[model samples]
Target: MSDFLVVGGGVIGMMTTLQLADAGHSVTLLERGRCGREASWAGGGIVSPLYPWRYTAPISRLSGWSEGYYPELALRLYEETGVDPEYRQKGLLYLRVEDEARAMAWAREVGKPLERVSADFLYAKEPEVAPGCQEALWMPTLGSIRNPRLTRALHARLSAMQGVTLREECEVRGFRQAGGRVTAVETSQGPVAADQVLVCGGAWAAALLEEVGITLPVRPVKGQMILFKAPPGLVNRVVLMDGRYVIPRADGRVLAGSTLEDAGFDKTVSGEARESLWASATRIVPALADCLVEHHWAGLRPGSPDGVPFIGAVPGLENLHVNAGHYRNGLVLAPAATRLMVDELLGRAPILDPAPYALEGRLAGGL
Candidate 1:
């Protein structure tokens, strides 16, 4: 048995386990299903939040800190694991933006570059985008990644690392507590003893905590996404209109995501979502209509109130910690959140302030 046990083998779980093992700690990751196939894989890997200015300060801080780290992280992961995460910085263009002023103001506040481009410039920059897009916000620095690939890279890295165990299809039953500390985890396979345990269970985190008398508001919010098979260079960059987005991949296929539905743990893809997303995506880039939709899927996002994840020690439990409830930004926030939790767990200085992600108020404001 490892000294550290991390529940939930999503991106958050795998990344944290990798970091702890890299720091010479024995860590084991438990996943109910496959690693990274849940919310982590479900999200469209947009590095920046959907709307930059709208999110709270905690999100901004973690996102800002992680944004700069992705390029380096992506490169290093590629170098070491040989799995290209396809991290691109072609920029995200927001068409028919509702609040350019708020976006620009927030950009200025955060020292991020946000530009307003004319229709002519928009058409010229991304020829695929439909013309006459009134006004658009061109966020140059932000871009996207191949989420499936990133999880593969993390999984590959952890597999190579010593003292790290990646257990898939391992559903955690509960925890064994000695006094207030978690001594072992009761998993589907069997009880795995550990000095400390961290729950990174994504949408299923709350139920796991409930067994140990720790009720946290981490419910499931189903997000549906679609894939369009187009040429590689058809869509140049990430395009957003309203709440829908189109993320172009290195290959010919492009990813058009995501519907925010509060469907509890139901990952069932719907025809309603398909028609709605198809209509929304085609509006932004009319050219996508010419291509065939390759696939459609859904993921259960761990919806916490205000969309801020709870990332610290669980109340009344000394060795138990949580790093779930990332809502929609699990992939975007994984690196920094993992680092923060690793630092705190290892008694090192934190990467960012930990107050905003505390468990105090979030538990009361249940989902």
Candidate 2:
């Protein structure tokens, strides 16, 4: 039997599986669709948590711990799998920020580099931004990764690793519990009995937990994004304005995202979202209006209250755990979330405090 059975093959699940394997545990990773096809693949792969100052302290801590490890992790993945995750530390320029004092205080507290850019400096850096931008907050240490490439690299690496079983297209139907533990996972194919289990099912995690009478508040929040085929260096890095931002790829592709909608369990892109995102993109960089809107799509983020993720053990279930509810920050938060999960499972002191992320006090009714 596999030592651990992990439900969900998105970034969180995949990263958890890898970390467990690194700790010398045999893991069987099950995915509903092809691994990494969900929000993990659909995301723009911004290394920073979206609007970092706006998130809670737990999120900030997790992201802060994860940020320093990306460059090395990306390089390691590339070295092992020959797939470059395209981790680039370009920077992010903030426009129309509502709370400069709050942003400054947060930046100072975290020791993050924040620079106030003059209009001349900001426009010179990204000349296409909308006019009348007086000043901007610049964080040069911020970075990005190509999501598809990172997932691909992880998939390849996981497949190559010993004590790891990668099962794509295997849908976990439910969990079979006995004596305060999940004995096996009932899957579309058959019953997969592992010594332990983890539900990292992203948006679909809540339903899976409900099967065992555990009501976690991890629900699906829909976000839509539009991709543009633009010239390289057109946007000059990442630009944020009024909850919408454009990410420039090393190649000539610029990604504009996204809308926080209450649309549940829906991954369908919309004409309305396209127009809105296109408007946002062009407003930031007018040149994008001329570029081809190559692709438009949507992904379901695992949304939790206050943007805090639920990570760690299910209260009564001894062998089953979870690492979901990251909302829109999964890509940036996965490294630390999964790392700390491994530490918890292995009974080691994690780099960051795992208390705030545990399902104990964070959840409302479920215990």
Candidate 3:
């Protein structure tokens, strides 16, 4: 038995493992399938949400903290694992043909460096940008990472660690809870005992918690994305549209996404959703007209009503913790979320306030 048994192997879970292992804890990660192959690998890679200034102050703070940590985290992973997380700081260029005043106000409030651009400015900067795509908010601090690479690097690092054990293709069937705390986890293969347990099963967190009679307000929000093989610097920065976004990668690929649907555990790609994403992306960058579709996939985001993640102890269950319900910002908030989770597990004071991510409120009958 290890010190901690972490269920789920996405960015959040892996990052949590990194923190725990770095703190000299014996950590075991269990994945139902391949590590980081789920939502973490299939995200748009936007490190921050569109219009983050409109969010609550706490949420904004968490995202900003995560954004700042990405560079250091990437560097550490690269140095140790010999795999670059490909974290790039190519800021987001959010365009808004509508609500220019609101955009300006938000930029000023958040202290984000933004410049108003007209159609001529767009044409001058990115000639491929659509003709009607005028007026944009450029945030220099925004950036993205190669999600798949980051996940792979984390997996490799964990595998190479002496005390860290990863059990892949191990679907957790239930939990062994006694005295109001989870003693161990029962998986399809066998039971693994540990002093502490953390459930970080992204979109499946709620269902996994139910096996232990704990209820968290986490639901699967399906997102469909499309990737295009455009030139590397075709769209240098992330571009945002009405509610959609386009992320350019360093490897001559651009990701366009996504449609938010409350589809339960459905990872199937939809033709209609693909068409919608294509239209939305083309509306922003028309040059994608000739781009070849390289990849199309879907992922289930663990969404909560308040748009904040559940990243603290499991209520009424000592030694049981949670680090899920990040929704779309799972990749963005992975670093901060994992650190706070490990702190809770180790009984250390958290650097960031954990109230917003408290898991007690959602417990049945308020625990």
Highest-lDDT candidate:
2
lDDT of 2: 0.90
Off by over 4 Å in 1: none
Q: For candidate 3, what is the lDDT?
A: 0.84
Writing each residue's lDDT as its tens digit, candidate 1 over 1-367 gives 7889999988899889988988899998889888888888888999988997999999999898888888988888899999999999999888888788898899889899999988877888788787767667888888688889999999989889889988899888878888888888988999998888899998999999999898888789999999999988888889999888899998878888889898777789999999999998898889999999999999899888888889999999998999988888888888899999999999999989898888876687655
Which pairs clash in the backbone of model 3?
A: none
Clashes of each: 0, 0, 0
lDDT of 1 at 314: 92
lDDT of 1 at 122: 86
Q: Model 3, residue 342: displacement in angstroms?
A: 1.3
Worst 10 residues of 3 by lDDT: 358-367
Residue pairs of candidate 1 with colliding backbone atoms: none
| Per-model CA lDDT versus the true structure | 0.88, 0.90, 0.84
For 136-230, candidate 3 gives per-residue lDDT tens digits of 66677787999999999999999998889999999999988788877778998899999899899999998998887777888899999999999
Backbone clash tally for model 1? 0
